[model samples]
Target: MAILSDITLYPIKSCAGIALREATLTRAGLMTEGIYDREWMVVDADGNYLTQREHPKLALVTPRIKANTLELRAPGMLRLEIPLGLPDPESAPARTVLLWDLSLKAYDCDDLTAAWFTSFLGLPCRLVRFHPEAQNLANMKWTGGVEAPTLFSDGYPVLVIGAESLRDLNERLHKAGRAPLPMNRFRPNLVVDGLGAYEEDYIDTFDFDGAVLKPVKPCPRCPMPSVDQATGTFGPDPLEILQSYRAKPEVDGGICFGMNNILLEGEGQRVHVGQQVGAELAF
Candidate 1:
């Protein structure tokens, strides 16, 4: 009896995630209060995406959903509030931002908001929102021809990790005289319990009551995991330890952790923590 142990929604790419008791599952990822996962992102002066991989302090930028605004707070920085309403597409300021190989048109945030991020990160950057008309699709090569849409995720709509997987890694860390890391270190969108260690790697689909999530690709590990979510600083990286056993030949020998997923059914369905999950193993 596998249970959905946790649900995390990351409104911004590579920033802190919000733990939710329930969230609406969408093709683009989890959504709550009309805000989709990775709906907003920070970009450099050249419009390239920025992340905790470069600035670990991004983990310290916390967001809270207010009545009509997305309130953001950071260490030693004043609270910044962004309107929840979508701006008019016809006249809203837009910019061409580069996210990996995809070039996307996004709504450029206000100058004040840009200044806030710039001052906090100590870099000239601006925050951008996913444009309503932008079409960001996952690679069909990995999706088996299923057209999976995403916002600013690396390559998938959702990431699912098994709880026992972390426990297994923690046990190894203990043996190596290293500190155990939290689930947030991996930043998975869905965490399932009651599965064997690394069981998610063999799962093909996670069937909830009205939704079906298909595991499409293996999520590769990055140095960003070394960033402590609490301190927003780099610590001893776990990649070396993971490389010893978690490297996958399918992903060209990239060290992997979670499974990148796509919505197979019930796009608008709501999923909650503690709900029973039926995992179908891959043949």
Candidate 2:
């Protein structure tokens, strides 16, 4: 039987991820303590989104959920706390940020928060939260016309990767005289065990109790995976190793790893580690 081996919630986009024993599955992604995945993001002064692709050190910005605030810390920086309570949409400072081809309305964080990120990242950037009224939808072409919503994710609402897939890649890496990479390098929201290598690629839907998660698209890998999650630095890139066999013609020959997913049913259901999962094959 396949079981959920890991559940990771990334509160801030492209930053450190918080491992959870259990998490509430939502249409937008995993949520815990009222904080949704990728709810907060760092953006340049021009409102363009910034990620580890440009600054590997962004991974060092770690977040911890306190009672009522999200505490952030980085190397050589003092701890910064952000209130969890939703700010008044009417009164909060707002900005128009560019994420990919979309122009999104986001809540501009306070100067102190902006200063904190700027000092650590060594860039003139500001922190922005997904505005309560903002609606960012995943690609309809990939979703087969189903209107699926996401926050700051690259495209999909959730990313699912099989444990054996990594094991398969690691075995190849070992043969190539390369060190095996950790699951964090891919940063999937859900990790399933007991499946064959790349088995997730053929899965049509995952049933967690009554909740239905539909795999919609292949997640294209980028140089972001080369960034070591622990040290917040660029290490050996595994794309060359992956490109030999993992390239998918469906995504325009982009090297792929995880499967991008969207919730089809039971939005508020809680999924826990070790929970038995039922997967339906596409065939």
Candidate 3:
């Protein structure tokens, strides 16, 4: 039987993720300690989103949930903590930011946090949290007309990948005399074991623990995967290897890896690690 092997939530996009033994499966993605996935983001002075594609070192900024705060730690950097409680939207400094095709409102964090990120990244940057009033929806074209909401994710609410898929890629890398990559390189929200290689690409629905997650879109590959999450450094790129076989004509011949998903039911349900998953294939 297929079961969830790991669940990770990225409080800040392109930075680091928190592994949870159990978390709430919400329409906007995984939620733990009242914080939603990609709930916080680091942006430039122009309010443009920043990611590992441009600043690979962002991967080293690890976050931990402390009592009443979200503590951020990085190599040779001082620890920074932000309050977990939501600030009043009416009083907080609001700014307009752009994430791909969507332009949304967010709360600009304080100068101290901005300076902290700037110091670590060697450039000017500011930290921002999703405004309580912002409403950003995923493209319905891929969701079969279902308007799924997401919080600062590149496109969808969830990204699911099968364990065997990574094993398959690792085997190929090994055959090519390259080192195997870890699951963090893929940055999937859900990792399931006991499925055939690349089977998640055809997943119709994942029914587990009264929750229904529909695989809606194929996740295109990017250079961010080449950036090692632990060292925050770029190394041997795997996209070239993937180009040989993983290219999807449906996505304009882009090399793909995981499946972007949308929540269909059980908005407030808790999903635990090691729980059995009922995977329905498309055909």
How does model 2 fare in lDDT? 0.94
Best by lDDT: 1
lDDT of 3 at 112: 97
Instruction: Give the alpha-carbon lDDT of every model.
Output: 0.95, 0.94, 0.94
lDDT-sorted candidate list, best first: 1, 2, 3
The lowest-lDDT stretch of 10 consecutive residues in candidate 2 is 131-140
Q: Of the candidates numbered 1 and 2, which has the greater lDDT value?
A: 1
Query: On residues 45-90, what C-alpha lDDT tens digit does candidate 2 reach at each position?
Result: 9999999999999999999999999999999999999999999998
Q: Point out the higher-scoring one by lDDT: 1 or 3.
A: 1
Q: Which segments of candidate 1 are over 4 A away from where they belong?
A: none
Sliding window of 10 residues with minimal summed lDDT for model 1: 201-210
lDDT for 276 (candidate 3): 99
What TM-score does structure 1 among the candidates reach?
Answer: 0.99
The residue-by-residue lDDT of candidate 1 on 1-283, one tens digit each, is 9999999999989889999999999999999999999999999999999999999999999999999999999999999999999999999999999999999999999999999999999999999999988889999999999999999988899999999999999999999999999999999999999999999999989998969999989999999989999999999999979999999999999999999999999989999999999999998
Q: Name every residue pair that clashes in candidate 3.
A: none
Q: What is the TM-score of candidate 3? A: 0.99
RMSD of 3: 0.7
